[model samples]
Target chain A: MHYWRDGILALPTTSHYLQLVILWSIPINFLTKSYEFMLSAKKIIKCLDDHWPVLETLVGRSTLGSFSFQDVQALIQRHSPGFSSEQVFREAQRLLHHEVLIPLAKSSQLELNRAVLEFIQFLTQEHQLGTVGDIQSRIEDLDRLRGKLKAAADTKDVSEMRRFIRLMDERVREVVKHFRKNESAIMHLVEKAKADDTKLSLAKRYSAVMEAFDEYIEPVLQMIDINAPFQHSMQALEHQLSELILNIEQTGFLQSEKEPLVQLRTRLLDMNQIGREALIRSTDVLMPLREELRKNTLISRNASALLAHLRKKGLEPTLEQLVPKFSSDHQKFSLGSANQITSYMAELVDFQDEAYQMPEQVDPGDNANIRVPDLAEVLKSARVQKANTDLSKWLAKSYPQLPVDELLFLYQELSRAPTLKLQHLEQYSTLEVNGYRLTLHPFVPTATSGT
Target chain B: MQIELEQLTQLAEIHKKLSTGYHVSEQDFALWQELDTNEEAYSALFTALGNQLKRDSRGYFHFDVDDATVNMGKISRLFALTTYALVEFFADQGQDPLRALFEVEISHEILASILQQQYHLFEQLEVFSATDLKREVMNRMLRYGFAKAQGEHFKLLSPVYRYLDALMAVDQLAEFPGESSTSSFTSNQEQADV
Candidate 1:
């Protein structure tokens, strides 16, 4: 009893105790929350805790996120030195239940949750980018609140007005906070992209750019009417507030309404201006991304087309004419640099030699022994042959009983003969040319010329 | 019915994009908002030029295709085939084609993998290399504003709804009745512009 009494007496006053409680509460609250999260996520955490060495192995591995259960067990055993299969199964089940680890559908693979992986990825990032989605809902919320405020004003409910005012103020503050945070995020993304030059592949690097455009910029732009849905919404709120002020002045009731209405109006104006600037800032950030996309896409498209040319005409012809090359690999050039002309000089002599290789010098002596027939002599011989006998008779004599292919070849040759003025006679004769039935055509007299 | 053509301030820009079949989206907010504000004048001006103003339910404006670009050669068929094949590929991979198209970073490797499955469909396109296919076909789609390229990746844009319609058509063919083919989402999504 004496000791208890002394303990109480030694304790500080009620206020001092309260101060101490307040002083320690922050860290205590944080610790408790962390503990709660750790507890909830314990199944996964316990698995890691039991096999703490596995973390080092995982961190060491470059390729991550997908591994078989057996592979996981191997990693676990290698790290923990005496890990059992039973323990592996138990811990895996626990992690799976907590959703800290996911078993890939239709496979024996497991992966960490996207959030955890992204957190690790964020750590690797020198510059970080953020997306703004929450604020869009905040703006929508403010619009909804304005409706309630208008209704409350009509009813002349003091409590309702106060509640609506407080709620609206909170919403506006949230929106402003969102705007600031998202602006910081954009700055981070841009800096990260700059820092990450060449470290990431082209696709991996521009993935963030695509995400910014598709996920953030496009959607936000869709939300804002600038002059329509938003403008109308602003005008309606302003009109309602002004009329409320007028009513308050008329009835001399709800004196508190004046300040809140003015504050709301000011906030609305700020939001209107902020929305535009937010979009402008987005555009400023995206301008570089956009330029990079355009340049890379342009270079890829042109290279593809040129490669197709290379495939068709072979390398030499394609290489002969110098195409414009983008030195995109060297420096991270802005959009302005895209149009900036750069000069490149290739050795024209080498390309010229390739393009116009001199025709092989055929020694005139190589073909001297081979007598080439004159065009007039060839024509006269064909005239003499045709005058002597028609095509079928000549075919029967010179190339009798030839195969179908040779017969067709002779037919083609006879058709092109200069002096063979042949005409198709319907069922004139059935001749067996090379064991194939032939519909022979009789000669037609041309200007009393006999053939 | 005659009015001064210059009354439509964005006439030249509108005409150029419309001629190329580029959908004028509200996301192109500045010019589109201007167009929206002056809808009456712009419509009239377009009508005077013998082009009908078309408003897509998906927050875009364009000229109705009275003049078929008439360039529907093997290349066009290849483009149409590739679009359909990709939608099928994503659907097979247990992904919603529409969402996947916008979300995924479509690199050369991915393109090659998907194309290998639809080899028969693209036999005539002569898409021997993934790079060539991207440059010749996918890049052309970019030119028509069906998608935008970021590095080697392409994120599809809203105008891809036109392709979505193509995809739906292919599904309707496969399903035949077109009743089971219709999801409640199709009608719901057709509501209005952003």
Candidate 2:
């Protein structure tokens, strides 16, 4: 696993050399021609009676470079029926040491060594997603490459310029590649979080959402933050590259570098956009869950507060204090039902005591001289006074000349007294006051009472 | 408050929906969108209506008014109880209450488990079984447009942040248990009672 991880990362570092070593390792036994490699292989070969054929047959039996040791005995029996179980066990140990069959972290799983597995995956072009390094690294790499490109340009060495362009192209490809790989990895994390294969508690399920945010979202998002150093550096790199393109085109010697330079710059700028896009897409998936988490916590916290309230004041007070009354509309407490009434209760209802006798009534009237006018008389008096203005004639004369509300206000002023007997107008007319609509009416003057 | 008849035509549906406690989210697109695009118009419209339109950062729009109706108080209490009890249950399970509650669907079984873990805290809710409890909680959530029922499970909606705001207040007050939650609940609601 260590070798594979190192080897995968080291692919860019020593590709010219590994291109040859990888070709040799496939046909030949795990030979780095290093002593360690030869020793491990020799160990396996020594354990087997005829190791080459058995190893080759075992490798062939496994498809996709992944074979389960679900039945190690069955595999051995099927491959070499004549071989003893004891012999197979010893040989298997040797094969494991040689990494002919690398052990999976999970038991009952074994796969071809990383070299072979990666090779198969490569040959099949079926790469899965995982973390691609952040744009920060790419930005940092560009800073270094910019110096190199400048040097190659200053030297006027066409071959060196070509070499730098190729290298820059590869670096950008790695960035884009990682962008896609992390895309899948993040998606896988999302799926794992979303999947209900196990009844992991809600808290357990959220572990995946947190993992996506912690491991994938935050770091990448920080790298590409619009004003962050990564973005500024990326913009600087883009500018430098565009300038390089113009210089290349103007220098007129390294015409070959321009196209790739343009491509590099395009990919360079797109790197930030795509990185942002991929993360946003992933975040979009997580947002609902994220929001849910937020809301639920809020609820739980409120519940805690209420519970605290409950503890302090007891249930009745706590409940009475809760907002919006009943949490659910379902808890409607009905008034007592008639069906519950009984004859015994009816006795209580029917039994009534006589009223206490009152003292002799006396009429105390007219001595104080506080003669209160009857409401009807006062209303009639007010109406007669209000009848002084004819609202119908006033509105007909003034409505077209004034805004309706003003006209109504003027009419209201002209007929404040109720004795004027204002009525809704017969025509299609209305007035708005305090957001309420009222039908228009002309004042019909009644007889005056006091005046 | 010079609400043009045209603007009134645009806002009529929004008024009805908001009155019913439904959030006029950006997704609503038609009714409240005018208010969303025009903050001044929203303010004017709501101001004329004697209520304030509050937009939570979470994308749903609701009203914030101090009518403090009886029904609203009851709902707040229910939210208070549910949120607190849920946190307690999640804590018991060694899970982050907030994250898990949102991320995982609270099915009847899970609801049952939560209720079963501690019934007394939820006793005031007057629910008999997990199913009844889930129904009550979800119905309230649905009525308030704070959650949507997905199949047999219910997921909380964003307006639930109102409760979260409450929870934070609770936490703050809890740290100083000397000060009762009731005092802070009102102040907290004033700040973010969406």
Candidate 3:
């Protein structure tokens, strides 16, 4: 009896050592054979622990709680070496029968949880983020990176591709985090920008206006020299200023009296003054200066007719030669340069003759009878004359049906007597002879009445 | 089709009387119905008769007959002439002595009665229906040696008045038959006949 009691005591010690051996062997087997398998098993166990309730809820039963033990055993076995698929299956059956393994429905939930946990771990470890705060901070870091990427894209800088790739990775992590929490708001923001046609158009217009101003107007303004810095800037912005003025006029943005454009105009005029000064300063020093002088002489002419008319009207008649003073004060002329002035006047007369020379008058007698050609013919001739010879030939070939006469008349009216009134055509009434009225052509009637 | 035509004729007569600003009587409508079977014929007769009966330019009938400006007396005279001319034209065309003479003579009596009843009703009224009537009357008028309707209105051939006067004289002679009452009536009747 004493011996049996001692053996029992020794058996407990051996059992303890055997359990320790199994525990030690497990880790060694995992480390030596399939570290990845061991990691997967731990991951699955952690997933189950985290999502136990979720799995149960998805399974739609409380039965999954009893299966938790079986889940742990299967996961442990799954990590062990020398375990056949049959052995794993038998273990799963035992747990399932005992309600230790969750239902198939709960298993699916567990698998999804495992995937999410893996993704989360990947994101945290790979991107160097530990929490939501870390994700937020990373996103802030990405802003500058994203701007650089955009600039690189704009400049087509191939050297920045690696930096862009790093940025893309970080951006993916940030986007995933954002999607998890504020998916709806982010979606709405994207959709709103996409759907709003007006906003899109406005954005385009704003960009286009900016580009146009930069290209066309900026260079012109920069070339001009101005004393005032503010004026120089304004001169540079002339094109934009003009555009603003046009917009104000066309849209009546100011005329509604809500937003007055006078302030804008005043600003523009100030700008113009600066621009003019700058232009003057920037003008080439070697450029020739122009000097013009004029002298006034009053002479009495045949005004007796006008004096008589004024006397008849009981009014005093006074004649005065009023020569307005020059508005610009750049220079002035003094008296006593009569000889030089006379020579200048003579030159001025010669210049005037050259500049204001009249064309020789056509002799009407040579063309007078002119057979009083058909108005239609006259109009056709006018059209032909107005059209370039090449264009006229092309038009004649292309539009044979066009009323040449009418076109000529239109051309003549447009060129010679633009202000001709329709009332001129109404002067002739239908002529009655022997109780019969004749319908004369419009031109004929006008011509006859005038005659 | 016949029923529609009859309805149309009635409507036209109603339109005509309404156009004249006159309250048509049942007897007058019956007389108008008896006068012509054809709707087009009736319109012509009615239009012509209206022109004859309403002498003043103030009423709807004067407006209908004289689209342009006309003095009341001239309208009255034109109305008289129109009625007489229509009756004569129809009589000559139909060659129905009784109906023709009857139409002519009745138009004169109708005028006299209408004038006696109220002359002021035929003055200063505008004719809004001339364009429509002119379009309607031209095709038929073309057959009768009458001038085609012109300028949104109809103008009677000048010779029509003479034909109407002759018809009226014949009718008056037939109706009076030796009643030599050389009064204003006889002279007026004679003028109408002439």
**Chain A TM-scores, candidates in order:** 0.39, 0.44, 0.18
Per prediction, the TM-score for chain B is 0.77, 0.76, 0.23
Q: Give the per-residue lDDT digits (tens) of candidate 3, residues A98-199.
A: 222334464432222223322332221211111233233444454455456546645646457345544544343333332222222111122122122232
Interface RMSD values for all candidates: 25.1, 22.0, 54.6
The per-model lDDT (C-alpha) reads: 0.53, 0.55, 0.32
lDDT-superior candidate, 2 or 3:
2
Chain B TM-score for candidate 1 = 0.77
State how far residue A65 of model 3 sits from its true place (Å): 12
Model 3 over residues B16-116: C-alpha lDDT tens digits?
Answer: 44343332222244633433334354445444433223221211111122222223223333343233323323322333423433233323333333232
User: In candidate 2, which residue ranges exceed 4 Å CA deviation?
Assistant: A1-100, A103-112, A115-135, A293-451, B1-194
Each model's TM-score, in the order given?
0.29, 0.34, 0.14
TM-score between model 2 and native: 0.34
lDDT (10s digit) by residue, model 1, range B26-139: 666666886787777778877655456777778777665422322323334455555655654454354555667678877887788656544423444566557777877788
Deviating ranges (above 4 Å) for candidate 1: A1-133, A199-203, A293-451, B1-194
Where does candidate 1 clash, by residue pair? A127-A192
TM-score between model 3 and native:
0.14
lDDT of 1 by residue, A212-310 (tens): 666667766766666646567668877887888888788888887788887777766766666566666656655655555323222222222232222
Number of backbone collisions per candidate, in order?
A: 1, 27, 21
lDDT of 2 by residue, B102-121 (tens): 67676777777666533544
- Model 3 segments more than 4 A misplaced: A1-135, A147-159, A162-166, A169-173, A181-451, B1-194
Q: Lowest lDDT 10-mer window, candidate 3 chain A?
A: A292-301
Q: What is the lDDT of residue B34 in candidate 1?
A: 65
